[model samples]
Target: MSVLETFQLAIKNILSSKMRTFLTMLGIIIGVCAVIVIVGLGNGMQGYIEDSFADMGTDSLTVMIMGRGSSRSVSEEDMYELVEENSEYLKQISPTVTMMGSVKIGSDTLTATSITGISEDYFSMKGYEVVQGRGLQYMDMTDRKKVCVVGQYLNMAYFGGNAVGQTLKINGNTFTIVGVMAQEGSELEEGGTDDCVFVPYSTAARLSYTGTISSYAITVQNTDQISEAKAVVEQKLYQVFSDDDAYTVTSMAELVEEMNSMVNMIIYILAGIAAISLVVGGIGIMNIMLVSVTERTREIGIRKALGAKESAIMRQFVIEAATTSSLGGVLGILLGYGLSALATSVIANVMPDTPITVSPSLLAVVVAFGVSTGIGVVFGYLPAKKAANLNPIDALRYD
Candidate 1:
């Protein structure tokens, strides 16, 4: 028979044994489905991580001063001058001091509200907007003013959304509210992003009773040159303390890249584990094809007696097996998509804060289909060879 005729006959034969063909394709279906779903989940997790990092602002760096085995210390002015000297890369610098105490408003003590001291540029550097009143100015820092800004959560909860010009006490020290920040989260809840307070860095240092500022937040002029800015800061700190352990400079962009790499590594490992099912499915195809050859031995003998070549017989079996596997792959792809959509819906409903969408890429679908078809060819070889080598003798009466 010609190649097209052989392929048609193979399809007819496969269709004649519906249950058996389906059973043979079941393994491939499961294997492909598993691989696609796992890859989609990995992609969703990676996307969520990137978004979380974006909220934290990847164009900035944080420096922590910890003088271990050294008596040297870097001053806040030194950090500012470092940014000024390296104006080619660095842009703004803010000394951050987190106060440890609950906020007091009259007789009520708001424990969920955090208090932090920051410079005037910190607001612009972090891209935070003040909707009511005005933000911190250079005068506030220089004069050690007891002025503060409240987040939307605290404002709405305590001051009925009219928190600007109101006063809240932190660490028993009264601070007048100069501005109210725009809402940071969708919902105003306790201990959420919009449940904090900000004061002048100099005022915070005095209230917290700390003469030395050990933490600093620095923003880069160009995000693409974050590494260069980080190196310059690190080099300046090293020159001051002469010890790498004295101070640590960390870039938010670098942290995001490291986290992404770790997530990808974990996903690759899980995908590898899920891929073992494909090998098992290939073995199943081989076993079923071998049984098929045995069951069709008589038919093969009749065809050979009618002058069919061994190559034609082999090609016919291989093509039928390939078609079976390809059909399974198609079904698996459809199922994977359905499951991915369902997972996305369920995640969005359950964890509204972190809505991770399961999205399978076209590349993954194509690879899965290609691998399934390739397995069919590789595993079907032995059975096809057996069928092609069947004896055509014995007069056909032994049946």
Candidate 2:
């Protein structure tokens, strides 16, 4: 018989035994569903992390002085000079000083709020928008103005979101709220940006009782120039701090790349774990195919006695096995997508802001289906060979 004829006969036989066919397909369906769910969740988590980092601004670098191995550390003036020298690479720079303080409005008090002391350039450098009033100016830092910028959360929680002109008591010192920042969500593990209170770095130094400000944030002219900017900044810091261990300079781009690599590694591991099911499914196909050959022994004897070649019998069985596996793969793909959607929906409810999305590639689906079919061919061979090698005279006489 021709190849098409053999496939048609295989299909007829498979359909004739519907229950057996369904049982054989069950393994592939489960295997494919597991793989899809795992991969889809991985992609979604990576995307959420990337988005959070993107919000922090990709063209920015953060410098922190550890002061572990050197007596002297990078100073605010040193940071300013570095920005001035690398004017072509850097767009803006901000010195950061931070402290924990209580913010109070009338009788209500919110404790342990982050009090960030930064330069006039901080808002722009950090990609924050001033939703109300005006941001701090150079004079604010130079004159040590007793003015502060409240975050959206603080403003809403204490001042009904209209604290732009209201006076807030920070650590028992009164300061005018000159600006209210736009609402910003949380950082990776740290608290939300909307909970912070901004002030001039000089004022923050007095509040925190520290003259030495060790952290600096700088915005590069372009993301492509982050490497050059980082090198220049590190060189400047090295000049100030003799020991390299005393200071560390990092870029958001570097953090993003590392995070993405980690996410990819996790996805690969999860996919590997899920692939175990496919192997099990292939073994199930082999077992069922073996049973099929035994049951059809009498039919095989008749065919051989009627002059059917061994190759024809083998091709028929192989086709039947491959068809079964491919059909299972197709059904698995559909079911996998459905399950992925449901999983994403549940994740979205838990974290509406960081919605989990299924972004499986076309190649992934194709590869999954192809692998299942290939498994069918590999496992089906032994059963097909047994059927082909049957003795016609003995098979016909069997009960």
Candidate 3:
């Protein structure tokens, strides 16, 4: 028979037993669906991680100095000089001093508000715009000014969005709010990114009673040269302390890459586990095809008695199995996409802050279909061969 005629006969046979055909395809359907969903979940998680790291700036590096047993201390001036010396690789540096205290705004004392002291250049580095009033100036850091910038959450919640020109006490020292940062997160919430305060690092140093600044945030001149800039900074700091343990330089890009690697490993492991179902499905297909061959023994005998070639008979069976498996795969992919969308919506509703969006890639869809169809071809071969090799004269005599 021609290929088309054989294919049509296979389809007719499958349709004649619809329930059995569907049952045969069940395993493949579930397997493909699971694989697609798992892969899509991984993709969503990866996207969320990248976005989180992007906000932190992959081009930035953070340095923490432990002062080398109190004998060797790297001063802020030393850090600035290092940046100035390597202007080609390094862009700008900001000294950071975290202040732990309650903010007393009028009669209310807000303890959940985070307070940090940074340079005037920090705002520009972080790309934070001052929506109200003005940001910290060069003089603020030089003269150790007590002025501060407040996040949108504190501004709107406490100051009713007119936080600028207001006064709030931190560490028992009153600070004038010179500016209000434009909202950081999508929406301002308590104890979120928008609930924070920033002051001059010089003032923070004195207020915290720390003689030496231990932490600095630096941005690289070019994003592509982050590793080179990090190397230079680490080398200089290593020279200053003469010990690796005394100072640590971390690149945000490197951290992001590491995080992505960890996430990918986890995804791959999960996907592998899910792929076990596909193997199970393939085995099930083989068993069903074997049964099909046994049930069609007389028909096989009649065909062999006629002008049908063994290869043609085998090819027909293989095509039937492949078509069945491919159909199952298409159904699974559709179901997977539906589930992915539902999962994303559920996550969004349940935990709105989470940035994950489950989306199955086209590559994943194509691969799932290919694997399913390939499984059909592999599993169908034995049954097809058995049917093709059946004795036509013995089949007629048995009846």
Candidate 4:
């Protein structure tokens, strides 16, 4: 028989037993869907992390000076000199000091707030906005004024309106609220602008009884010059700390690269796990094909007796198996993409800033479809060979 005739025969046979054909293809459907959904979620998470870093500004760098187990200790004065010397490379710099303390408003005491002491340039360097009142003035830091800026959460909780000019007690000391910050959602794992209470570095230094600041936020003149600026900052910091471990400087780009690598590793691992389903599906295909050959024994005998070559019998069965598996693969791809889109939409509602992206490349779909078809050829071969080699006389006499 011709190839077209064999294909028609295969289709007729499959259609004659619709329920059995569907059951045989079920495993392939599930396997393909599993792979697509797992890979899609991994890609979405990677995109969200990259976007978060981009919003924080790639031109910015953060510097931290260790206070213990170091050969040298960096002071606030060293940070000032570094900024002045590298004025061409540096745009804005601020030494930040932070500590946890209690805030008192009349009879209520909120003790879980983080108090951050910062210089006048801190707000601009960190991309913070003052929705009401104003940011810290130079005089506030220079004179160690007992004034502070409250976050949006505090303003909404205690004052219920503009918190500017309101008096609040901090760590039992009376301090006047000079500014109310705009709501900036959390970017890092620790906390964000919404959870902070800003004060002048001088007052923070006095309260903490230490001249050493926690960290510094520095912005570069241009993003392209980040490498040169980082080198200059590292040299300047080294002069004060002497040991490399005493201080650390990091840029947003480096952070993004590290996070991307970690996420990619996780993606491959999950993809490998999903691949196991494909193997299981292949095994299932082979078992069903074997059963199909036994059930169609009498048909095979009649075909062989009527001048049908063994090759024709084999081709008919192989084509049927491949067609069945391919159909399941196509359906799986459609269903997988639909589920991924639905999952992304639900995740968006829970976290507005996080974006879940599905990969637009059809590579995964094409590869999976090809694999499913290949699986059918390999697993269908034994059963097809058995049918082709059957003895027509014995097959006819048995039934």
Candidate 5:
């Protein structure tokens, strides 16, 4: 018989035993779906994290000091000296001092409010735009102005509306609200441009008895110069701290790279788990194919009696197994895509900055796994061979 005729017969047999064929295909379908969904989730999470970092500005670097054995703190003078030394390479350097305090507007008081002392560079470095009024200016820092910028939540919590040009007291010290920041998404709620109140660093220094800046934020001239700028800042910081290990200098790109590495490791681990499903599916195909060979023993003997070649019989059985796997693979791909889309939409709603991405390579791997499972006829070989070798006369005579 022609190859096409053999394929037709194989398909007909599978259609005749639709329930068994479907059960056999179930394994491949599940395996493919697992791989696609898991890998796509990994890709989406990575994309989401990276985008959040990008939204915070990639050209920024943070510097914090670690002191000697007895004390662990950064001096205000050390931060000022570092900034003065790196003025050429740095675009803007700001000293930041943060604390959680209560804000009071008239009789209303909101607790657990974020208050930070920052320089003029804080706005641009953190990608914050002034929605009302204006940001802190150089004069504000130098003059130690008792004015501050408030986040959107604080505005609503304290003043019940736009807090710009209003007066809010922090820890018993009243400050005029000169600016209000635009609403940044939830990603910023953790640690970004939003969800904080900003006062001049010098003013915060006067208010706090610590007399030290917590950290410094430095913006580079360009992203390409971030590495050089980090090195330069570190060198400058070392002159003051001298111990070299006392301070930590980190750039946004380096942080993102580390985060990506962590994400990739997670993806690999999940992918490994998903791969096991494919093996299980392949075994199911093998088991079903073996049963098919046993049930078709008499039919196989008749075919051989009609001069059907062993290779033809083997090819027909293999095609049947492959078709089952291939059909499952296609269904799995469709299901995987739908699952990815649904997950991405839910994640996007929660984290506007994080975009979920479906990886094409993951899809390819799923399809390949399905095809490999179909080719598991190698495992079904012993049964096919036994059936082909059966004597036609005996098969015909047997009940």
Candidate 6:
């Protein structure tokens, strides 16, 4: 028979045993769908993290003093000397002193306030934009200004739209509000930016009574020179602090690379699990084809008696098995897309700031997964050949 005729016969046979065809294809459908959905979720998560990093500013680097052989604190003078010495690569450096304290204004008091001491560079590095008043300028740091910037939540809670020139007391010390930062989505992790408060580094140091800073946020002018800058900063810091292991430097690029590696590892693990399903589906196809061969034994003998070639009989059966798997694969693709969409919706609802993105590459992979299901015929071949080679005389004599 012609190839077209064989395909037609195969389709008719599958249609005749619709339930069996569907049952055989079920494994492939489920397997492909699972792979697509899981991989898509991993892709979405990676996109979300990248967005978060972008929102937090990409050119920023954070330097913290670890202990020298279990020491906890590093002196401010040491941090200053390091920055002053390597003033080429580093554009701006801010000494950070964090104190979780209550801020009171009139009768309203916000208790969950993160009070930080920072410099003018902090505004640009952290992607903060002033909505009202001005940011802490060069003059503010030089004069040890008591001016501060309040986050959106704090402004609404304490000042109630009257925050531009207001005075709020942090840990019993009063700081005049010079600026109110714009709402920064996920970047403002602890609620609105207005909820947190920023004071000059000098002012914060005096208020916290810790002459040493907790950490320094450093910004690099040339991102490509991050490695060299880090090396320079480390050497300078080691010289001034007298302890080579007193500080640690962390770059955003390194952090992003680590995150990507973790994401890739997870994707690989999930893909491995999904592969098991494909194997199970292939086995199901093999089993079903075996059963088909047994049932059609007499019919195959009659076809052989009619002078039908062994290759023709083999091709017909193999095509049928492949068709079954391909159908399953197509169904799986549809189901996978549905599953991905549902997951994206749930995640978006939960995290309005982080969006899930599904790329064309993911869709292409799903399509390739479906195409690979055609390998089911390879497993189904032995049974098909056994049927095709049956003896016509015996088949006719059998009841």
Clashing pairs in 6: 67-71, 151-193, 151-194, 152-193, 152-194, 153-194, 154-194, 154-195
How many clashes in each candidate? 0, 0, 0, 0, 0, 8
Models sorted by lDDT, best on top:
3, 1, 2, 4, 6, 5
Point out where model 3 deviates above 4 Å: none
TM-score of each: 0.96, 0.92, 0.97, 0.81, 0.82, 0.86
* Model 1 whole-model lDDT (C-alpha atoms): 0.88
Distance from true location, Cα of 399 in model 4, Å = 4.3
Report how far residue 48 has shifted in candidate 4, in Å. 3.9
Candidate 2 clash figure, as a count: 0
Clash count for candidate 4 is 0
Clashes of 3: 0
Per-residue CA lDDT of candidate 1, range 164-243, in tens? 88898887888899999999998999899999999999999988888689999999989999999999998888887888
Top candidate when judged by lDDT against the true structure = 3
If both were scored by TM-score, which would come out higher, candidate 3 or candidate 6? 3
Candidate 4 on 44-103: residue-level lDDT in tens?
777788777776777789998775544467777777878788888988888888866787
**Candidate 6 residue 166 C-alpha distance from true site, Å:** 1.2
In terms of lDDT, model 5 sits at 0.75
Residue-by-residue lDDT tens digits, candidate 3, 50-160: 889888878899999886676788889999999999999999999999988888888888888999999989998888899999999989999999999999999999888
Please tell me which predicted candidate would have the highest TM-score against the true structure: 3
Give Cα-based local distance difference scores for all models: 0.88, 0.84, 0.89, 0.81, 0.75, 0.77
* Tens digits of per-residue lDDT for model 5, 1-399: 777887788789879988887787776677677778777777767777778788767888888776654454556666666667777667877888875567677987756567889988788887788888899999998898999998877766556667888888888998999998888765434234355788998898888865566588888887887898899978866765678888889898889888989988987787677767766777887887777777777787788889888887877877676667777777777777788788777777986655677654654664556455545565556556666667777766545
- Report residue 283 deviation for candidate 4 (angstroms): 1.1
Residues forming the 10-long window of minimal summed lDDT in candidate 5: 186-195
**Tens digits of per-residue lDDT for model 2 on 1-399?**
999998899889889989988889888878777777777777787787788888888899998888754467666887788898889998889988877767777887867578889999888877789999999999999998989998888777777768888998888999999999887774321246677788999998988887588888899998998999999988877776667888888899989989889988988888888887788888888899899888888999999999999999999888888999888889888988998888888778987777769766566688889988998898889999999999999889866
